[model samples]
Target: MPRPRGHPRSLRARPELQRLEPKVLLTTFTLTSPTRGALLPAGVSPVGGIVIDLIGEGGSRVVSQIRARDLFVGDFEGGNPPESRGNPGTIGERPGFSPAVVDALGGALAELSVRLTVDDGDTGPGDFDRDDNTLLLNGIAVGRFDRVPTVETDASGTAILSENPEGGFRNDRVDTGFFHVTDPEVLRLVLDSIRDTGAIVVQLLDDDPGDNFFDFTVGIDAALIDVDLPPEPQNRSPRITSLRVEEPVVEGRPSRVIVSASDPDADDAITFRFALEGDGRIEPSETPGEAWLTVPRDGTVRLSVRVEDDRGAFDEAGRAVVVRNAAPSVTVAADQDAIEGREAILAIGSFDDPGLEDGWSVAVDWGDGSAVETFPVDRPGPIPPRPHRYLQDGDYSVTVRVSDGADASEASALVRVRNAPPALQQVLAPRRVTLGTPVDLAAAVSDPGILDPLTVSIDWGAGEPSRIDLPPGSTAFESAFLYDRIGSFVITVTVSDDRQESAVLGVPVTVEAPEPVPPAQAADQALAEALLPADPADPRPATLAIAPDGPGRPAPAPSPSPATLAAPIATLVGQDAPDPAPRASSPPPIPVEAPSAVVSAEQTAPAAPPPPTESAGVAAGSAEAPDAAAVGPEAIASASPSPAVVDPGPDPDPDATMAPETATVAPAVGAADAAEAASSTAVAAGDDDPGAETRSGAMRATVLIVAALTVRRGGSRIRQSLRSASVRSARS
Candidate 1:
């Protein structure tokens, strides 16, 4: 059998060609000729045949052809005469046939066929012609034809070749059926033979010998062949067009999954299936290609959906979903006390599912008719505190809410707002502090609400108060100051919370001055007191006139002789010194002088007492002596009582009381002597002469006055004796 003409040679490498399955290559040919007016044998106007050539890349060739004599068989100028032209019979209808020679070589052959034609001129040589053809395979006779067209003859009895008066051949179209080796084993041998030998040949031949004598003109209009190639299996796995699942899968909660699939082969039937390998359960839904699922507690859920075609072609798609717990729990806290115009802090906390605690967001409400605030939380534990300030005093509440977009929770707390003025709890200070002394002062200051920052200060009377700032929530404060001046001072302590409110407290302190000392005197105090009597009738009158050197009094005039000097009359024995001196016979006694200035009365009682001195004899008469006995009755009657002398009390033993003046000279004699001097001196002068008597009394009083001054200068013992003597004298 002939191979198909114009088969494409293999363009692949040897290894690629081996990979290709063996199959017959099909081709078709339309035959035509450019040689039109060639000389022909008698009774044969024109004849033609067609041959096809196939060339391979490896320098191989294959050929196939259509025979001309197989169609239009006739004999005219030769021995046989032509029969009627119009009637022809069919060829390929019979069933019985002998196998060709090439059928033994696996009988893989390409087929060939031809159509015969005849035409007349314009005068009409042949007007009607039927298409009749013979088919050939590998040069073997395969088909016989009988249909043909006939031409009318003119009076000359000649067949027309053209209908045109100008003379031209007929033009028409015809078809040849396809033929080729289709058996797998036969096609494989054929392809192998061609590949090995590098070539194969096909030819066409006229099977009727008598028809060949007419040299019938044959034309191959077309040739076609079938190949051993069937369509590719066309079995394609189904493709997963789309896969989807409901988002945010939660533990122990049902989720939905949707899957879609398609196959390239439209006629293929497909079935869908689903699987969940871990952390979840999956089941097919009532609808096709859909499923329902529940995830396990925490972790990933792996899901796979598969689609299978009727031809066993299949495809699958997989997905992973992470499951989490429920909504988060939130809590908020803040300081209970809040002060107006002060800042307060509120803290937040949240707890989420065990493995899913990371991402979150928070919103807060200050509960004071203000907008809510929101922020994202990057950390999982306690959140940083948020700060807020209140402008007015009132009670306020706070809230904090947390969310993970899908779930949320919240917590709340309360904050108390108050305009608590600064308070001074206690001032630790001293009452009596000395000038120039640094006193430690401390004040316990506090705010009952808000615990806002406070300032504590102390005004230390002398200057501006020193101040110290306290941080929020502080209580006690202290400082020190030195008072520069001394007096009653008021200390003020002021405490402020820096929030337009403050408090103050005050304290008192006192100071004093020193005392002065008195000067000492040298006069005798006891004698002087006796001279200046309290009673009007007493000797005070005489004493004031006669006693020249009494307390706060001036000294008497000095005389030439000591005995006549009244100023020295205090030198009298047994009396304070300054007693009158006695007169002498021959020589005048040395003059006695008086002190320059009057002594202070307080100096009479000196700090220390003087030693006792022996008694000195008083003058009985002197140049200036006067006689008290001669005084007139009027002078005597008018005389006040002598100074009340401090009398020494008589001793229980008479002898002691009568003891000599020398024995009592220490203190007792002074008192007694002062008393008697007034009278004794008077008596010793004249008792009959009134003028002399008055003069004597006056002199005596002067001596007593000086003696009293000396007694006062002595100690407490001497003073007691004076008192005793004064009492006795008064009694006497």
Candidate 2:
């Protein structure tokens, strides 16, 4: 192991002797040969040991060296001098050392300071005493167990035994201490020896061997050295090049932040961390450098990411992410025409960005002072139908609102309600009726839906007014009025529903006067037929031209008076016989009232008949009385009718002369007698003829009054008075 002759100075100089870099060593040593009761035959002992030199060109070197020890004890029971132990033996053996020489060196020897640990199970002494063991490394005493402290148990609960009165049993008592090689001379001497020997030595021996024999063994589980390898480049803080949110940062929406960083030292591992300033959820993503976060509900959210290396150096980056809410948009529509009592449907539609689709609700206001209703919406689309009813008739504004917890939008529409009026179906009434008759008025009315009570009114035009109320389901109304006067009239009907809607209709009515009758027995019969009474059940009131103590004002009845019959008979004859067919000739002359004067001759009469003689009238009147010459002509006719009236005038005297006197006397007599007979007949008719007489008298008075109104056709001087003549007499 000596240096080679004339080698390079670097190579020749021993590492232990030169000013060199510090090195580390690890040695594992063990002793197992001394069985439980082995005796102290203290010549030499073989201990298996190895040296791990941790310094070489590649920074690692292992040299296994078997070791031996020699114990030359005088008394042998502990208390050996430190100089006598002289470091038991070299830790790693030289290639040529023998057993005695190995022990002679006192332990493994090397030219270096050392720090070491020893766990000893050597039960060298049987009991506690002044004698104890001493430990050495490189011939420098390091530690001692002088008091022989009580054995402590290991992790398995077994007693850590030392040299005791009984024996060493299952002990791993640890004694830790360090030794420094500070003396240059001693270090040189040891280095010279290592140049020759190539080993380091450590030892344990009895301090007072005469009293405590060295009969125990020890094992070392670990012996290590500390050295400074080139210090790794100081760990550099990780660099954060970029940091950002991966998706659009919509408020309340989930997204992620991505960070990019690097560690300067290749041996350093890195990790990422994230944080936010405002409301949000942040977590690590699948990727190491990315973090997941929920977007905050604010103007801007601060996001920060930190990259840390294994050496605890970290770098951080911050970002301000703009946070926005997706404002919802909605539209509202409703049925245009809504009835006051009917239900209406409102259609609402809405939409939003996908991110805000959840946690949203819809609200509707019916604008009629009703509560607003809210409905949760799971998806963005049309909202469910909203139904509402309006009690009042007017225009109402409807609104729909859509909100996504954070934002809202609204739309409005107009819902108008209409009021319908009542309808008038018809007005039933008679157009014409006689005075004093009652007119019935009726009407039919209706409204759109089931209506409230209806009010019906009629203006009967003649000052009679009537009103009636019909219940909800009824549509008919009736009224009655009597016409007091003879004239045209109008009736107006009005129908109204509870809502104050109304309609009106008009009807016309007319009333007329009755016809009059003339006075006579025959006329009385005619009047009876014409004025027959009406049926009782008739809705119409009885009518009469002449009112007498009735519901209406009474009017005067007409009086009966005589009417002539001669003119009517003469007119009948004139119509039945034509002038050419039959002519009464001069052979017969007709008497005015001969009971039935009949014409006998069929010969044509001459155009001019000679005037009558005065003596002709005397003879005609004297037939009934002698001395007729003494009576005036008027007296003679008043006395008695000529036989022509009592007895039929003979064949109207075919021999009768055309005497001017005859015509005068005969007509005068007949007139007087006819007047008397008419007067008598009128008296006989009595009460029956009173109404007819009244009517006839009214007619007569009307005609005379009409005649008086006429101006005379001739000169005023020729005017004559109209005498009060009997109606019969006037006609004759």
Candidate 3:
């Protein structure tokens, strides 16, 4: 399509294009796709894939060729190749974005700005810069797989858009999420053009580049249909529409102040600036109509906003915001279901009194016996939610509490934790199996729900699938399989529980025709097989079963106290302990007193978790330990600078009897202090390695052991062992 050098409007009207009467033709004008930017008129570039005066309503061109100047809209000089592959190359197929504004723009609303954000199945409804290897709405290069309503660029830097997207990602049409288009030039065309012609003629194109049509696909989805457009436009001084202040603005907390203004000019772009005229503060955006206001103390503050258009004309508006020292507010969005052993998410929104700079603290009771997590915050922002993984399948009520020194707020969310899929612990399948000779296949699987029934389905990749049902609570199974076909096949095994959740394992196998075994070799193999250990009557593997300690369930006693743990220590390290005769007179289990959580004076807390199941192994409660993951090195290092705590009571007997397995152990004094100090050193030294987190847990156990051993060695040895344990913990 060639056009003369001087004309901006390459579209000329054909009277026949007018299907409606001259009086009422404008419904709404919108562009659903973006176009390539080649062969556009001289001074025009579809910067955001927009063109003027080209309209397509109901999928047909409203105007014919603009041949009034002796040149018609024609096909590109070269387009399709000899091998078409049956895909018709469009005429004059050029990467020329010819999205025409609805002729309603001649008198419609004047200004708009189109902003886009990436939805990578994570944080979005925000803003983003065009990343390199732009996968602009999946138009050109084939990119990585992203969820629908997402914008992702491939790692190889190609945004893939093919004619046939089978078994791959294809989201050609989508909701132009939260559209707010405000390009003044486009509005002017639509608003005034309709006034001039009484009918809006338009075309919306998302198409190919010139001569390159043979390779590239047709278009990319970019909807301007979502843009808000008014029917009429008038030239008048823009007035402030609204100035709102979000209420309950707490001191040291940030609150939202929304401002709006309207311009009736055909092509005016308004720029707004804001100022806090009182004790409050605000970081004004150059062209922002809304801002966050923060004040140091509780009081009233005045906010003034000024709006100036492209012209020198301007208008001013003011609003009052009340800041108070109120309890922090919290709102957590109900997130998707959490898989067992995976982090459960809580989407917490922020509520600022005015946008204060003070810090706060939060506490979370996981409703599991694991431990309560506490985080001390130092900034006046939304406190981060602690991460916790449930160990079993059940409902758990997670509670979140926040304190800002003087005031506190709490919330809760009901979380349903589904069973974790069975794990493929071990598999035994030969790479090459003799055809028709009984080939043995064995797979070991374990489920977190020890009582749940399990099944294993095997697909030999020979179009046959075989399933084996294991005994209830069984964790392993072995079977003999016979392959009749002689070819390479993938032995795929899928292990699923009643929950429909499953785990799969695949191994390659080649079944070959059997070869005759030598008589001596066959006898030797038979003797060897006869000597091999017979398959166990029960195939279940011996492994430690994880017990779920739900809320309200008191912890079972073990060592009792560090003062009398010498005997129990031997049993813990694998030495057997003498079994005691059953006694109904056993003392009640000691209360499991957990650590304390400290809250700061300036924080806002997020939402809480769900309630707990009745038969939990460990009750979820606030058990705050300032680990390096939540808090940083400085915080961890200073967490517990106090010396190792030793009870001043008379020393207990060194040969004190150990408590029964059901007996509870009291927490050791200064153990948290030692663990925190050790963590800080590890973090500062950057000892990040594979399984560092897992090792940290073991280190804590070792700390408790050392603390137990020190009780019998007297006070002097206590300090020495504490230092030794702290030093050794860094490498853990």
Candidate 4:
């Protein structure tokens, strides 16, 4: 008989007698490497397209393929002849047999014989012992088999027997060869290993090439192998601590950005890259650990700082620092006591950043056409305020500019510069007064908003000096001066209030002279003569020196003697004296004389004859009367001479008698003396010796004396008469 294909055959002997019908059953088996089992009967195939279903009754199935080298029967521990594929004559002498296969089969039987005794089977003539036992070969019954046992068949008759006398046997065994390998621990281990390497395993499922079975293979091609790379340390968020900018950061200045992070895992050493956000530029820094960025001039910029670690972790921070092209502000103020045209101190206001490493400077423009002053402030300290003076009058604008290293600020002050002199308002007292008269000088000074105690000075124009004092309204400057000079004089008054001075004003003063006199020539002369004296004989002369005898004594009267009368009369004569010869002779008298008594030497004897014409002849009984008659009958006949010499003298013409008594002096004087002597003697021999009679006689003597003296005077005869009459009347 030919060995059945795809199945194992056993060699055994069987009895010739009945040919038992074959029974067939399909069973599933899981085949795997290191197979250990008895070969299947001839002409049978394992179930489900498997060469062998190596599975427990209710356990998981497993399958594996053996490598070509490990598939040889000699690799097994048991000595069993390899199964034949061609016709075979005996169980051991079949074609295509290997001796290792036969020995493996024998060894398997010997092991089984040790465990159990063999069983007899039917045999025929020419039958050979073959291992073809159909025992209940539970895989669990057999504890373990090193190698599968092969079976041998005889070709002469259909009988199977035990070839090596170790019959087929049953034993308790676990089918460990069919390893139910669902080890979750092993899968976990594999996955952990992959993870440690930073890799991931991908499983690929495919149909097995030799069967319709699903198989799994690890796809290392798709596996992600994570090498021991440092994890990208969690990206640290950056923080901006502060922002600073210079006075003015131009294009040349390198702006800075500082970055910080809170990542403990990050190394302090970092790589920095700076970018100015929003239209900004950056220049690579030449210095180590420095990031430089530039802000474009066209627009403002916000800077961003990016810091990266060696592990490719990065942090970003941003801040804004302004960049400007304009200067800053500086203010200026003046002290309260500042004065115009004098030194004034000013307070320059605060600056933004006065302290700078580079020196700072200040420039001032004091509004006037003056030179600008520049001061340097290199450090932080109190700057001593400076003094400034303005001369012109008006409001002024003061500007101050402070410069830092790169920026500056300016401030302006409307310094009201009042260089104008104050206005002078004058107050005056008694605006009008008399000329050449004294008056009180008063003046008041008024300046708007000025304090009291204003200095004042007055030019009174009266040769008085100026006075200075504080005025109470219109204060009076009392000074007495006579304005004798007559003209308009300007009284210049000037005032000053220290802070300002005023102009001088001139007030005009008028002076005039007193009034003039009237004319009355005659009356003036008469009054002058009356006030003076006429002659020395007249008690007082034209100019008198009347010496009072005592306290109450009256002035003495000069006696009326010839010399006394002649002296004053000579003065008048000298003033009005005619030819001397004409005045020397007696003047003719009037014929209206009373009859005169003849007082001859015999007058006592002659009460004798009352001779009228005869006595007249006696009175003129001389050649003088005849001569007076011979010269002119009228002169001789009207001759009225003195009783003593009228007849002897030249006859006074009647026309001469008509002349003033000042022309008839001799006749008048002789007659007046005779009369006076007669009265004196008569009074001496008064009848009763009466005082009244004495007084009458004295009065008559005075009258006669005055008449006689007056008749000898010149000028007018009427005037002499009136004067004599006035004297007589006054005495009476």
Weakest lDDT window of 10 consecutive positions for candidate 3:
632-641
**Candidate 2 RMSD to the real structure:** 21.9
Off by over 4 Å in 1: 1-256, 261-273, 283-287, 292-301, 306-426, 433-454, 459-490, 500-505, 513-732
Query: What TM-score does candidate 1 get on C-alpha atoms?
Result: 0.32
Q: How many residue pairs clash in each candidate?
A: 63, 47, 87, 51
**Model 2 lDDT at residue 465:** 80
lDDT of 3: 0.39
Q: Model 3, stretches more than 4 Å misplaced?
A: 1-329, 334-337, 348-360, 367-369, 379-381, 391-396, 404-407, 414-427, 431-438, 444-453, 457-477, 481-492, 503-732
Candidate 2: regions farther than 4 A off: 1-392, 395-414, 432-437, 449-457, 464-476, 496-501, 511-732
Which candidate achieves the best TM-score against the true structure? 2
- Estimate, for each residue in 636-689, the C-alpha lDDT of model 2 and write its tens digit: 011111122112122232122211111101112222232223232223323454
Candidate 4 C-alpha lDDT tens digits along 454-538: 5667777767756676542333233344676666666777776555466577677666655433233233222322322123323
- TM for every model, in the order presented, reads 0.32, 0.34, 0.22, 0.26
Q: Candidates 3 and 4: which is better by TM-score?
A: 4
lDDT of 4: 0.33
Q: Assess candidate 4 and give its TM-score to the true structure.
A: 0.26
